[model samples]
Target: MTSNDTPEPTRPVTLWAGFIIMCVGMFMAILDIQVVATSLPTIQAAIGVAPDQMSWVQTAYLIAEVIAIPLTGFLTRAMTMRWLFVVAISVFSLASLGCALSNDFTSLIFWRVIQGFSGGTLIPGVFSAVFLLFPQNRQGIATTIAGVLAVLAPTVGPIVGGWITQTYSWHWLFLINLAPGIVCAVLAVWLLPRDRADPGAVRRLDFVSLILMALALATLEIALKEAPQRGWASPLVIGLAALSLVSGLAFVRRSLTAVHPVVELKTLMNRSFAIGCVLSFVLGIGLFGSVYLMPVFLAFVRGHGPLAIGTIMLVTGLAQLATAPVAVVMERRMDARLMTAMGFGLFALGLGLSAFQTSATDFEEMLWPQILRGVAIMLCLLPPTRLALGNLPPSQVPDASGLFNLMRNLGGAIGLALIDTVIYGRAPVLGREIVARLQAGDVETAQALGIPASVFASRIGQPADAGTAALLTPLVEKLALVQAINEAWAMIALLTLVALCSVPFARAQSIASPQLQAKAGH
Candidate 1:
């Protein structure tokens, strides 16, 4: 016998306090992902991690999160929404404590993996509540509240992380979660309904499907990370990619055949939901990729510290705040498909604008692009959300929500990998070009890189000394880096534009699915 999600009719919930706490819990979880991002160097030194091993600090959490995200519906059903959230938050908080207490790299990574697995469920969990807990008229407002925080946490993470690291020890990053976590947990138990956990559900769990999915997602994430660094053809990268593909295919087959699938793989067959997932994927690339790109350029190319980069990043977050209300209003009145197109068009334009950046590009030049992406983010989120989960029957929303949210995360992971591939792969080639241009006395090229005319003249026709070559190396590297960054910017911008191709095919979705309508007819 398979698991069915249909619930007995219950009174509509107005548990505002519990719901708010739930959103806050989700926000904290999302925020921590980025909070640690800007402070990785401080963390690396404190934990005495080697430079080569440092990326794992972030990767471990991400790989775990990616694997866990799709299991949200399964876990929610087994434990019930109320208890699952409590358990996840408790574990997440304890993991935070463990992360703060770790004295070595190995221990920190261990805690991070646990932290990510628990935290991953919070995102889709809250979104599922929007449909399950609220009526049609109110879902717009609830979703906006959740969406703003969802996008906002990541946008503001750099500033928050930078401030925390600069003001106190890096341990404060994780320690900050302890109080909030405790409070949220207590409030959850008090305010949420006492839905009994199903011991039978746990017993019937499909372990084979679970293992396949975990292996597939984990290997896929690690492969994405490795491909850019080690080259796509590297043996280790190829093996990981192959393993991921095989396991992923097998997982799909198992889910389709199994009586009690861990996740609802059939959710992808819904046309609007599928398109919405694609849009979500594209949004993730632009959203996470932009956030990722801005910091790298600032820290590496512009020689800015964490605080300064955070200041510059504030533009995106501020824009997101200002436009959120208007977006909510528009989403109610407009056709979701048109709104989606307009949002992606502006977003693509925003991304395209950054592709022309030079080594000298900074906050002012970055200002408009960030603002455009920021304003566009609300549209990207609100409409696609409605398209994806809006029409699903209440019973199916949790599982569908997990799959919808998963696409965005997977997009972020893949986008970052491609961005890195461009930067690391193209930089050296461009660096050699810059060196050749400099050797051939191309002052125009030098001037474009911010070298003054007089400075170019002074260096021309001079015998290259060790000091001169040392002085020139930095410039060549910076020029190459900015150019490669711009190329990557172009790559994602085009991908965003390409996503628009699918919007035309996405039929406008009604508030309720046909299954719900049929049930209502009775």
Candidate 2:
């Protein structure tokens, strides 16, 4: 048996205890990322920060995650895996407290950067821990449980934040992190194994690559964030985008040739890892893209409050949490390809349903889509995670896990920016098109087809009164705008389905049977 495949000594605590601790860590991290999203307006008002500065709250965390994630291999190996978890939890918990007490945006952003350093390690560390804690046969179940908890944080964060913000204060969003973060810290220390650093291990510490990656990702993130507000072709935006691409390419070249790469090039060369990276990127597009678009769409079109939107999303988050066990069972019964495809199909369907939304649609209409998403996410996430690390050399698991999650978070940041630019760019044009058609008696055309004049007029308005029609035009025009958003959702759905096509290229790996373990001299 591989060192990784051996079971741990039976202790008073069960494997589930590790899962619980990991979940608490994950919940705190995810909660912090999103809970602040719902409270940004309040935060800005409280601190008297400019709107542009408010974006830094999110940008700082994401930048830190991006900067820290690619370095996990070095970090994990330099310190043992267990100490990494303990340190990460302790740092994240302390930062959450600092965030709660921060009197200004600068202070909050500074602590958030600290939080990111700790939070960034948590996912890869948690995944590595699961693999270490469980035998290969049970990896699927372990990963599935981890995936469910990971998904739970983002889905529930905003909902919980909204409730907390509305009922108490926006400061509570950061305050809420403190209790869970401390719990996670305590559990991590008590339950997790301590690390033993390899003093002789190579630590490349490439100053140039680190700087390039940070600058490239930071520039790209900034460009994406600003593209919607300032046109993409604007001088500042173009300069940043160009710098991002050039620096990114330079880093890629440097990383590939470096003796001790910050990112392990060889690991990503594996077909499974390559496909997994692609899948993770696509997932970023879907996960963050929707999160960016949906709440704003609901608020603008249907006028829902953050609390109401959060409530609906809470149900979805709970559904995701509930599916963890089922996903674990399914992983054993199904092929990675089939399970991933089914998951993507459900996710696409959810996004597809969202494509047709109108302002008049009730809150209930959104719930089912979110439910479908919960299912799809659980299905897709577990299998890829299993497939990626299932066959890796035990020593390389930490690197693989780190790269895998880095793509997801980077994808989230970029994806949100891309989708936002698209909707903002297209919605106005679509609105105008509908307004023009209605003024031309697309209604008269309807009336000519035996639809009543009153019905046509009530719906699309009289073609003759151009000024009045123009004044009331947004009502009819918004349907077209809604359809444009649907188009975006449809594209995301299709992208998920397209991601499934990569599954054929993935290597098929079977779990080691318990019987096989017994036969093999266990």
Candidate 3:
């Protein structure tokens, strides 16, 4: 039976119970990555991995997750959403336990792959339920819950990770997932209604397409991750990039023609859905980029610890929570396109404001921009999600949800790569220029850098003593790095503003299915 025709629980409690469970699963999954990121140094030391090899802990999970995301449509069809959630959460829980118990890097990486694959499905699964289970009127609130979890998990991950690692140990990061994973799994089985699995769908698994998709995404993620350190032109990076491109093209061609495609790329033909996907991609860039930029800045520029960084970042989350109700109200009453435009505009303003920051900038200086971003991220997410999947038929929802979510992740990957390029590429050049100006007797620059006139004169056209050069070197590097970071923030803002042009392409009205509207009316 189609999703609309499937029987839903008559009681509201049961429906929402199942949904909350799903959200719990999704929240845990997304939160896992960030929490691990915050505690990686400890993890690396404990696991005895080289500094260079340490990134694989996260990279392995990311590559696996990216590959699994697109396969959700097929998996949901084969196993049914209920069983899928049950199995995914069970595996995720088991994987978490395995990770916590791991004594070696190899075992940790293995468990992380399993954890990532299982966790990946939870993301699209939660989104698919908006149309599959909820009525049109309630979808705004439903979307709000999902969007909040989506935005909130990353926002608070560092805080939670910091507390766990600092107060207890790094193992708690994985051990913590055990309770929620089990609880979510049990709740799914008890609360979610069962649907018959499609045997035909299971039989039609496109192995070739799956392999190509996996290779494409895996290589792409690795390439992006390594490009910054290895140099984009390095043979390893170039080979991976070429492999990703070829595999990606093959996956696209195969999915288009295959009778039982893994992903539903054709959904992009719908103007609204297509625009929503674009918006999702751009939002990913801003959301993930900003999240990345903040912690690094606080850690390196300001020398804040993880707990402090996470605590300060809470401003954005608090702002998001405050604005969520407003987003819910607007989703019901306002033009999604207009709401989206407003969101991107405010988010850009926040990002642009952050671009002007100095090395000394702190909580007070960042408060307003954090509030703007906190409020704006929800606006950016809620409407675009509704616009993308609200109108798609049940059969299409899974595919569309997977692809839509995939865009956000892809945006994060691509955005970070570009941001890194800007930072690393520009910092040295700017550093040299600033040093040149200092040598050229720019009085204001000298005064601002706290360099004595005699010292400046001594350094002119000659290498100064180690003490003077040491002081000046660090100052120059800090200034140059901050400038580069500002450029990155500005670039993100411009990209966000550019996303505004696509808002007009989204349907102005809610496109929720008639059945959903009818159910809401009842």
What is the Cα-based TM-score of model 3? Answer: 0.95
Judging by TM-score, tell me the better candidate of 2 and 3.
Answer: 3
**Per-model lDDT:** 0.88, 0.76, 0.88
- Alpha-carbon TM-score of each model against the true structure: 0.94, 0.91, 0.95
Backbone clash count, each prediction separately: 0, 1, 0
Which parts of model 3 have CA positions greater than 4 angstroms off?
Answer: 1-7, 447-463, 510-516, 519-522
Q: To one decimal, what is the Cα RMSD in angstroms of model 2 from the true structure?
A: 3.5
For model 3, residues 1-522, the per-residue Cα lDDT tens digits are: 233345345478898899989998999999999999999999999989999998898889988888888888888887888989999999999999999999999999999999999999999989987777777788889889998998999999999999999999999999999988888888888888777677677677889998999999999999999998888999999999999999999999998998878887888899999999999999999999999999988988889999999999999999999999999988877878888899999999999999998778889999999999999999999889888987787889888999999999999999999899988999999899888898787866775566677766766677667887787898888888888999999999999999998898777775456576767533
Q: Rank the candidates by TM-score, best first.
A: 3, 1, 2
lDDT of 3: 0.88
Pick the TM-score winner. Answer: 3
Give candidate 2 regions above 4 Å deviation: 1-15, 199-203, 444-477, 517-522
Which segments of candidate 1 are over 4 A away from where they belong? 1-14, 194-197, 454-465, 510-522
Clash count, predicted structure 3: 0
- The per-residue C-alpha lDDT of model 3 at residue 231 equals 89
A best-first ranking of the candidates according to their lDDT comes to 3, 1, 2
Candidate No. with top lDDT:
3
* Candidate 2 Cα deviation (angstroms), residue 495: 1.3
